[model samples]
Target: MKYSKIFQYAYIVFAVLFIYDAISKYMSNGDIYYPSILLAALAIFIFFFRKRFSKKFDNRDNSK
Candidate 1:
C-alpha cells in the first residue's frame, strides 16, 4: 500500500521529466515530439486517476 502511494506520486515526477524533454527538444530543433507530449498527458491523466482510485479504496477500507 505504501509503495502504491509512492508510485502514484512518481507519475508526477515522470510527467515533469517528459515536459522538460519536450521543451529541450523544441528549443534545440524547433520540432515537436508527439510521443513526449502524449506521454506527459498520459502521465498526468494516470496520476489523477490513481489519486481518485486510492481515495475510493481508502473509503471502502474504512467502511469495512
Candidate 2:
C-alpha cells in the first residue's frame, strides 16, 4: 500500500516533468515533440491506474 502511494505520486511527478519538457521543446523548436507527448500520456495512464488499484485495495481491506 505504501509502495502504491509512492508510485502514484511518482507518476504525477513524471507527468509534470514530461509536460515541462514538451513545453520547453515547443518553445525552443516551434515543433511538437512526439516522444514527450507519448511519455506524458503514459504517465497519465499510470497515475489513473494507481488510483484505481488503490481503491480496489481499500475496498478489499474494508470487506475483511
Please name the candidate that would achieve the greatest lDDT relative to the true structure: 1
Cα lDDT listed for each candidate: 0.96, 0.92
Please give, for residues 1-64, the per-residue lDDT of candidate 1 as tens digits: 9998999999999999999999999999999988899999999999999999999999999999
Task: Count the clashes in each prediction.
Answer: 0, 0
After superposition on all CA atoms, what RMSD does each candidate show versus the true structure?
0.5, 0.9
Ten-residue segment with the worst summed lDDT in candidate 2?
Answer: 1-10
Estimate TM-scores for all models. Answer: 0.97, 0.90
lDDT of 2 by residue, 1-64 (tens): 7887888989889988999999999999999998988998999998999799799989999999
Off by more than 4 A, model 1: none
